[model samples]
Structures are given as structure tokens and as C-alpha cells.
Target: MTKAIRSPALVVRAFNVEISRIQDQTSDPQTAAFRLQFWQDILKKIFVKEQVFQNIPANPIAQELFKVSSAYSLSKRHLEKLITSRRDLLQTKLFRNLEDIEKYADDSVSSIYYLLLSVANIANVHADHAASHLGKAQGLANILRSVHVANHHKTVFLPMDILMKNKVSQEMVLRGVNTDDMKNVAFEVASRANSHLEKARNISVPKLANQIFLPAIAVDSYLKKLQKNDFNVFDKQLQQTNALLPFSLYFKRVLNKY
Candidate 1:
């Protein structure tokens, strides 16, 4: 019953897990592409009212997603964008500037928030705007936290503009070399993320949509940590979630404050 009640959340969680699995487990691009295509096809089926699945989807996640689709008028484009962004990440794409990074965040992060809003039947323009910025903030903060691991995996999320301006080299980032330039670049990106977060907070969220922004509390905490660390991307401690993160998120959710 609990699982049935939270099927939408489960679907989102399962999709994210599959993405992580592709990144961590799959080595061949062709194989990864096939896997992503499979999910894409399944999503298409889910969107169609009569065609739930050509074959019964054995994957629990897909089943849950199908259930949610039946229950709510979920946006197919937003859900598809989530998968597309993950597919894009499979092929290396260097972010050219802050705009590039923001676009990526919007595609990868904002799309999910929009889907969540749709699940809650939130249609207000202001809530949508707030969710978009909040998604950016959360996405950027997440990348900031994973910089060390991503660098080690030869993945770069920092914008080229920031790296160039700060004279931070790709090799330096890939090898986890901590430098003043890297710190500066992190500082700029973190600053931009915080600005988006502030913008999100300033907007009035509808009472029904308040819980959708619960992730904001976590994003806010991460921004504060980055500030405390002087925006050091290589700080090992930054990888750790705040000790009180669960409690903080719970409190914020219960209080209906993002």
C-alpha cells in the first residue's frame, strides 16, 4: 500500500538509479545507448492511454510509473527530458559557459521538478518558475558536492568559461589537483547556484506545492558549506551530507517552508 501510494516518487527514484547504474556499470557506449532507448520506448508506452505496455513490464519501476501515469496527467515531455539529459551525459559534453551549465541543469533537474508539480496538480506560473530555479540550485549544488568523484571519473561539470577565467586546467580537475584557480571557479558556480536559490525562495510557493520544494533546504545547507569552505571543490568534507540534513529536511517539510 505504501509503495502503491508513492509510486510516482518510486518511479523517479528508479529512473535516477538506472542512470547511476549506466554511468557506473556500463562501459560500452552502444550497450548504454540500447539501455537508454529501451527506457525511452517504455516511457512512450506509459504516455499512451491505451498502450500501457506491449509486454507486461517486469521492472517494478516501470510498473509503478505506469500506475502513476494512470493516476495523474503527468507531462510526458518533462519525463522524457529527464531521460534525454541522462542520455546526453553518457556522451561527454563540455559546458562552454554558465549558460551551458544552466541549460543542462534545467534539462536534467528542472524537468523532474516540473513532473513533480504536475503530479501534485500544481499549475500556477509562479510555482513553476520557483521550481525551475530551485531545480537549478539543487542541481548545481549536487554537482559541486560530487566534483571530487566526478573529476576522478574523468567527468567535468564545471563551465569552460569559469575554468578558463580562473586558469583551471582540465588535467588539474581530472587529477583532483586543488588550486587557487579551481577554488575561484567553484566560487563562481556556487555563487550562481545560491543566487538561483535566493530567487526561488523569494517567489511565493502555493501551499499545496510547498512540499515539492523540500529539497531546497538541502540545497541551502550545501551552499552554506561551500561558502564556509571558500568554495573549494576538492574539499573531502564537502562530499558528506550535513549531519542534520534529514532532520532539517523533515522540519522544513513539516513546517511547510522550503
Candidate 2:
């Protein structure tokens, strides 16, 4: 499904339209102002962000999206961190261990969670809970998706606790062996991260789970596809279904009602 919009241009349009819709739903001047400023920041990040969109092959669509989005200075400091730290991240060798990996995590998508808040029409009172919950979900999903690629690069991502308990070594992970303890360690890392996710949802705020709704459902959809094909994300051969997002819209609606 993926929003029924495959082309990169259409995808950018879809995201812009969705942001506008969320803003209209908010209908508050404060929310409106924040939304405006927030998206302006996102657009800026789109072109300037080296981690996600850097090295994208030159194409008409890529040029258009980058041109339109990278127009302003990001308002949040962490969003600034994503921009400022772009050079540091390029030096992959520096992040050779778990501690370094967590720092990398903080640099990349954890900061993106800050941008997601900037764009969403969620309010101040709800901000803390909203951010924490949504961040953990997105962060976990990101870490899961990029696990293999990261390991290949000599950057460590598994929690320090899991690494210690399982007696796994950084060199072993980079070597890419799927040891039993390693698999268990990865699962434990995810499970512990989910526990943090649950903690973030403890508050009874309106539209609290809305941010994570689509991602959570996408995770389930991806997991099901993996099961059917006898594939796992860590194995790298299991690709996510394009239809995942379309079926996930229903779940998003339900969670938004939270």
C-alpha cells in the first residue's frame, strides 16, 4: 500500500499532505504555528541530512525533493545535531563498539524523533509522553531494520548489557556469524527497548499512540511476511512488503483513538 504513491515525488507530496491534514485537525493557533515551523525544519533536513538521503543517486525526483525540503535551519538542537554531526558519522571507524553505537543511535534517528514531534500537532502537556513513546518505537524499528548493515560497518548497536551477558565480542559481530547467543542477544536488545517503549506510553494522553500506530502495524506486517517466507530481518534477505502501509492504516486509526 505504502500510501499508493510509489514515485519519490509522490511520496514527498504524500508526506506534505499528511502533515497539512494533521495540522488542520489540530485547529489551534499555537499548534498551527508549531506545525508550520516544524515542517519548515523537516524540509530543511530533507536535503541537508547526510545520513538518510546522502549519496542518493542523482535523479529528477531526488533533486526536486532535496531542493524543496532543505530550505531552512532546523529549530530543535538535536535536529541541528543531525546536521552538525554529519561529518562525524561519515567516519564509521570511530564507532567500533556498543557505546559508540549508542552514541551513533543518539545522533541519527533519536534526533529524528525530535523532528517528528516538531512536525506533529501534538500539544505541550502531551509532549513528553508522546515523544518518549513514539521515539522508542521508531528507534527500535530503525535499529532492527539496520542491524545487519551496521554490523557490517564495524559500528556496534546492541545494548551493552546484552553484549556483556551473552559474552559476545565486537569483532565477532562484525564477522557476521549468527551464533545462538547472538540471536538471543539481539532479541533481548529488542525486547528491552520495547519495555522502554511501554514505559513511554504510561500516561493517558489524547492521540498518545498515534505516532507509533503505523510503525507498530508495519512491524507486525513485516514480521508476518518474514515468518511466511522463513526469513528474518537480521538475515537481510527478508524485504518488507510494499502493501504493509496500506493494511496498516486501519490500525493507525484505532490507535489514534487512544
Candidate 3:
């Protein structure tokens, strides 16, 4: 939370949001791929030693990212992983199994943690371990929350394996079916996310990195609410924002717990 890293962290997060929204913003797969390529090319230029900032595109996010990357000696591979994962997601919208989703979470989510840790100069394995589990937890929770919207787009992000195991079909989800089978799938996915969150909390990370993991509280809160709603991913109550979340996060941050 020091002033030194505040701007860099914000820039990195802004970059993540931009990359994540590409799929939602573009209807054409080719357009999405092209946009992802633009990021990839930007990353390459950002990492180049000869002309570090000279050839950077006229994009604010790219420009700030280059500055942070140079200032903090951020990992090029970690930054590249973010774009590559999004590119892969563009190519394969549906996951085959829970493990596939976890891998996607690691690539798309954990890479952010890795970069943040680098910015904070934290090199502990324990911190990285916690970040890995936390990323999976947050990523899975995000997928659960997006079920309604993804279905509206005629796309299903629930793992195909889980859906098959629960006797739920993609069409069923796309049609916004609120059956017991769909609830079962949600329950299973939520349970997996909960397990990862528990594991993350069990680890001992550096105090400096605690703030970085505050998203855990949000993930934990959503899972609890999902359970209360009987694991219904399409619950209208789930769509409403938690007004107390800000207070909750502030309390946790004050307690030095993530």
C-alpha cells in the first residue's frame, strides 16, 4: 500500500481489466484475436532492451505497463502469460474439466499475483503458494458469478465435465434453467472454490502481500451467499451488490488479514 507501488498496481490492474474485456467487447473471434495480438506485440516492445519505451504504442495502459515493468523489473513471462491465456480463452471458450478451469485461473489470475509480488520485492515461496490458491478461488468464484451473463450470451463457462457429471446440459444453462441439476453443478464448483480459499488462508504469506490478497474476502463472501441461496447461480439475489463489502474489506485490511 505504499505510495511507491500504488500507481504501478493500479496500472497493472487496469491492463488486466482491458485484456479481460476483449471477449465481451468483440463479437467476432478474429477481432478478439487481433486485439489480443496487439497486446502481445505491446508486451514484446515493452520488454525490448534497445528501445524500451520508444516504440511503445500510443496506448495509456501499454505506456504505464512499460514504465512499471521497467521500474519494478517485472517478469516478462508473467505479463505475457496474461495475454496468452486470454488468447487461449478466445480460442477455447468452453473448458473440458475442472482442472482445465484451474489452469486457466492460474494463467489468467495467478500471473497478476506474481507480478504484484515482484513489484513488492516479495520472493517468498509461501507468498506465491498462497497467491496460486487465492487466484484459483477468485477465478472460480468469478465464473460462478458470470453464469447468468455468459448464458445470456449463448455461452457456458461451466466445465463440460462437471455439467455431464451433474446431468446438466449447456443448452439447459443457456436457457437459464433453474433445475436441481444446475444447482448441483454450482454447488460442486463453489465447493472447489471454497477448498482453494481455505488452502490459501492456511498458508502464511508475507505481511506486505496481505493487502494483495484482499480479494479473498470478496470470493469468500460470494460463496457463502451462493450457499445461502441454495447454490443457485442464477439467483436474483446474487446479482445484487453487497453494500457491506467495502466495510468488510476495510475491517479485514485493518486486521492485517486477507
C-alpha TM-score for every candidate: 0.92, 0.54, 0.98
Q: Can you rank all candidates by lDDT, best first?
A: 3, 1, 2
Question: Going through the candidates in order, what is the number of backbone clashes in each?
Answer: 0, 3, 0
Ranking according to TM-score, highest score first: 3, 1, 2
Off by over 4 Å in 1: 1-6, 52-54
Instruction: Give per-residue CA lDDT, model 3, range 1-258, as digits (tens).
Output: 667777888988899999999988988999999999989888888888866576888998999998888889999898888989989888898899889899999999999998899999999999999999999998899889998897656789999998999899888888889999899899989999999999999999999899888889999999999999999888899999999999999999899998
* Tens-digit per-residue lDDT, 1-258, candidate 2: 122112332434344344435433553545655655554565555645463655444544444455334432323465445433433543333434344544555554445544443334334556545455545554555555666665544465556566668887767677776677776666654554455456555555545325423344554454445445443345655544466476557656654622
Model 2 per-residue lDDT at 107:
53
lDDT of 1 by residue, 1-258 (tens): 123325576577577677557766766777888888988998877776577454537987887777777778777787788778877877755678878768778988887778777777779999999988998888788777777876546777788888888888888888888888888888888889999999999999788677777878888888888788877778777787578998997787777888
Better of 1 and 3 by TM-score: 3
- Pairs clashing within candidate 2: 1-243, 43-69, 44-70
Best by TM-score: 3
lDDT of each: 0.79, 0.50, 0.90
Which candidate would rank higher by lDDT, 2 or 3? 3
TM-score for model 1? 0.92
